[model samples]
Target: MAITIALAGNPNSGKSTLFNSLTGSNQYVGNWPGVTVEQKTGKYKKDKEVHFTDLPGIYSLSPYTLEEVVSRDYLVNERPDVIIDVVDATNIERNLFLATQLLELGIPVVIALNMMDVVRKNNDFIDIKKLEKDLGCKIVEISALKNENIDKLIETAKSVAGQKKMTYQEFEEDVEKYIKEIEEFSVIKDNPAKRWLAVKLFEQDEKIMKEFPLYGKETRRLEEIIEEAEEKYDDDGEGIITDGRYNFVSNVTKDTVKKGRKGMTTSDKIDRIVTNRFLSIPIFVGVITLVYIIAINFVGGPVTDWVNDVFFTEIIGENFRGFLENAGTSEFLTSLLVDGIIAGVGAVLGFLPVIAVLFLFIAILEDIGYMSRIAFILDRVFRKFGLSGKSFIPILMGTGCSVPAIMGTRTIESDNDRRMTIMTASFMPCGAKLDVIAMFAAFLGGSWWYAPIWYFGGIMAVVVSGIILKKTKYFSGDPAPFVMELPEYHMPSARNIFKATWFRCKAFIVKAGTVILLATVAVFLLKSISLDGHFVDFNADPEDSILAGFGKIIAPIFAPLGFGDWMASVATILGLVAKEIVVGTYGVLAGIGEVGAEDSSMVALVASKFSVASAFAFVFFNQLTVPCFAATGAIKEEMGSNKWFGLAIGYQLLFSYTVAFMIYQFGRVIEGGSFNLMTGLAVVVLFIYGYLLFRKDRSKLENKNFSNKENDEVVKYESN
Candidate 1:
């Protein structure tokens, strides 16, 4: 018979590392059915029949968060043969909190004490035998990172499979009386988890209460018991149980564990500076600026130039064109191969070096645990805008890709916060948009500061949008409390960093080959066919092309933002398909026979069509607009309401248009251009925007007044 083991733990407990060690390269990743939370399953390298499910890292089985609910549901319903609860040895007290809950599940479990090396380095000692006895489970010490005792841990878990275990800890007398009463109530008598269910009932778990039917008398009795207990303890039943569990864990640890000399550790010492109240934001900004400088200018720029100029332009384009001529290949076919496919896809692929470098740095930051600290440091600022620090996580992920970033909002518990996050997350420029930003930066004389301007611009857009959205009725409540465990800082694993970087780069490469290839082909075809409805030669003027006709129709809409030419309008429209296509579209529209390093001809062409002011406006529009169609689909799925999805897309379009419009018209005035109707419109937009931004939220005022009135009434009643 095949044995199934489920891995569960708190976040940053090294559970993922342990899973990677046991499973090696044999793993399948997907979402759990009907939910966006990721579910990973893999078979043991040594025995394929023995499978493992890596549950989302969660602190408890409470249904407070989506992750907790998914983990709890799987453990309760799927009932895997064995659960290997990976525990961080350095933080045994907090790690065992989840272990205590798992014990009540009636499923066999083994505690894998991970990071034992770190524990021993600190000179702390844990009595494994006593801990095992106290928790009523098998315990194995292992360094998941070093691959030590992994085999033993798996063997121990397999041995405990399918066996029932009971928890050694018990609740206080008041809580225990009702738990026993609930067990004998007979409604859930056949349930093997009667004791666990009874405790959940005492805690008044709404989900659990709705699951089972209770007699009216049993309900009243339970309510009365809970109220009396709450009155006696001056707290809710949930808090009482929580305090009791911690008390039990404290007793168990005091008896069995010995602490080393207490002092600030290395991680603490670093956090003191990196997470300082005044210096954190400036430090974060400096780090980000340095990353972009290295990726865009210093390292990735040279590599990208070579790939574009030598590899594609010289070798591929030149050699292919020469061969086609010698073989007398048809003119139309040559144009399609060189101008359509090569120019378009090559434009995107040229940025592969930049994307790789960026992903590598981001992966390193994440692996070294600095990303979580960024979230922690930004929580205060985020809460002021009515978003939890958790929202910043998706925004950070958005810097890589918006699809996963929007989906990452599933971790947020509040519906309002999740939706708001989904709406604003895409405002951050994604990896795909990097090429567009780079192209515009090159157009603006290749200054290094161009990249940071757009990068920070996207961030400011998100912040401003958050403030505006939170004041509205749809997203007016206070943000949920921010609580996240900061993992210990350690040396980044090169293997993991390379793997993460490779996956991100691979995804970009795949899109270039698939989605981008098809889109570019379509663009070439549209631009090649004449408006009079006949195929045309490459030498023909682009104004006669069908694409020009369509672009002309949309060009007037963008005239206010400058770059009203049909080609620029068409490229902006195509960007909605994929942001990189904006650059590819320009390459195709410019009709450059061979693209070179920096594609000076294409950049020169764009520069002629757009002044500095207009170019920056164009960049702002593309950067702030709704992300690609794939990301839109993700937003739709996450929002789960077409109405809300439409609202999100509409808001993004309106905001991008206003920002771009202001940049162009105001910019023209500054550059000695005439003030006209568009300038007046821009002034009006600025005024309205200022009013919305500075206006006090009427809802907050009303709430404050109502609160003061209630306080006054209370004081008057007390005086009486």
Candidate 2:
């Protein structure tokens, strides 16, 4: 028989590291059953028969969130042969709460005490043998990161899987006499771990309490026992069970665990500097700036330029066009292949290195545990703006892709909070938006501030949106308190960072090569084809072509935002496939395709065509749009309706356009520059919308017969 082993543990107990080590390249990540929460499962490296299911890192089997529910459901329905409960050796007292709960499930469990190296370094000691005796399970020490003693852990897991069933008895007192009575009832006599089941029932765990049907007549007796226990404890079932588990964990820890009198370890000392109360913000800014400079300027620029100019612009583009011309290939087909597909999609794909580097840094921060500390440090600041501190992770990850960042909103528990997070998550420039930013940075403006400015624009949008939305009646709740387990700081594995970077970069390539490529070819066909034999050069003048004509109609609409150029206008039309392509489209249509060199040459080409103010406005519009296909799909999935998704997109477009229009019009005046008539009108219209957004729309009242304040508030809230 194939043995199924479930690895269960608290978050940051080195569970993921252990899973990565045991599975190596054998693991697959996907959804668990019907839930949106991601599930990771893999076969043991050498032991194919010993399949491992990596359960979500959770505190207990409580059904409060999708993760906990999925984990609890899997354990009850699948009933793995053995569970390797990974625990942090340094934080055994807190970690054992989950361990103790897992034991009650009546499955054979082996304690994989991870991070033993950290424990030893901290001068803390754990009596492994004593812990085994206390929990009635095998205890094995392993450093999942270092790959130490992992083989022994697997061996012990195999042994436990083959052995007869062993169940853990509760170590804490039974405050409820009825809980004990329920365990003793005749209906529960056959249960292997009646005491554990009884505790869960008393704790009123919906999963367990609802299972009383299996007990039949004894179910009534169980309920009576639970009532008596509830009265005696003077607390609900969940609280009672929670307190009991904590009490038991505390006793076990007191007896077997000891902390050295040592002041601070090397990591703690480093953390003080990195996560310092006052200096942390400056340090974070400095670190992020350094990351962007290295990635965009040093690494991404050279690599991306090579991919764009060398591979596409020169080699493939010129060679292919020349070959086709020599062979007397049709003009339409040549344009479609060279400019439409290659220049359009290839331009987007060229920025993969920049996005990959950004994602790599994010993964490093998360894996090393600094991400959580950043959250804790920023919680107070973020809360002041009516956004949760947890929102920082999604926004930070948004630097890579907004799809996952929006999906990360599922981690937020409050309904209003989740909605606000989803709305602002895409405000951060995602990998897709990087194409536009890089394009503008290279072509329109050449300054180190270009990249950082886009980043600050994204962040400012979030903060400003939060403040504006909070003042409204619909989103007027205080920010939810942030709660999360702080994982021990450790050296991040290069392998993990590389894997994460590759994953995001690969997604970008697939999207550009497939979706963006098809869209660009379509645009090319529309622009190049004509019934007459007149050879119209679409590149010289885009206005006379189909794409240009289409953009011309919309150009007047966006004239107020300062970018009425057909190239900029048409690029926005193609932005629906992905945002970054807008910049690449601009680069091609702006007649910068002939630039030979990488960084400086490309910058020179862009600067000659557009001003800095217009460039900033262009990037702003792209930043505030309803993201790409992937992110839109994610929002729909997370919100569970098209209505919410539509609202999210509509709000973003309105907000983005208003901001861009303001900056372009008002900013020009501040710079002592003359403004266009349409731009001034656009600004005036936005002012009205801004006023209506924050205040009552009294115009609707004249037509309506009557309205309730509650109904009006609801309508206003949903509109926002």
* Candidate 2 stretches greater than 4 Å from native: 24-35, 45-49, 162-164, 172-178, 191-193, 213-241, 299-307, 319-336, 471-474, 531-535, 538-540, 587-595, 598-609, 675-720
| lDDT per residue as tens, model 1, 460-488 | 88878878888888887778778989999
lDDT for every model?
0.86, 0.75
Task: Tell me the deviation in Å of residue 598 in model 2.
Answer: 8.5
> What TM-scores do the predictions have?
0.94, 0.87
Question: Global lDDT for candidate 2?
Answer: 0.75
For candidate 2, write residues 1-720 as lDDT tens digits.
688899999877888889988988898887777766778889888878778899987888888777799888888778888889999888788889888878877788899999898888877888888888988899999999889999999888888785666756453465645566677766465676576777776666677766654467676766776676678778777777787778888888899988874687776888789878788888877777776776676666678778778877788778888998899998767776777677776677777777777778778887787877777777757776567887776776687888878877776767777787888898888878877776665564346666676776788788778767766655666677778876767788887788887888888888887777777666666566433434467565545666667777888867777787766787787787678667556544533335554443445545664566677787888888778878888888887778777888888888888888877787667667876785678678777757745663233342343556667988999999
Clashing pairs in model 2, backbone N/Cα/C closer than 3 A: 203-237, 443-606
Q: Give the number of the best model, judged by TM-score.
A: 1
Q: Candidate 1: which stretches are off by over 4 Å?
A: 20-36, 172-178, 216-236, 592-599, 709-720
Among residues 3 or more apart in sequence or in different chains, the pairs in candidate 1 whose N, CA or C atoms overlap within 3 Å are none
Alpha-carbon deviation at 655 in model 1, angstroms: 0.5
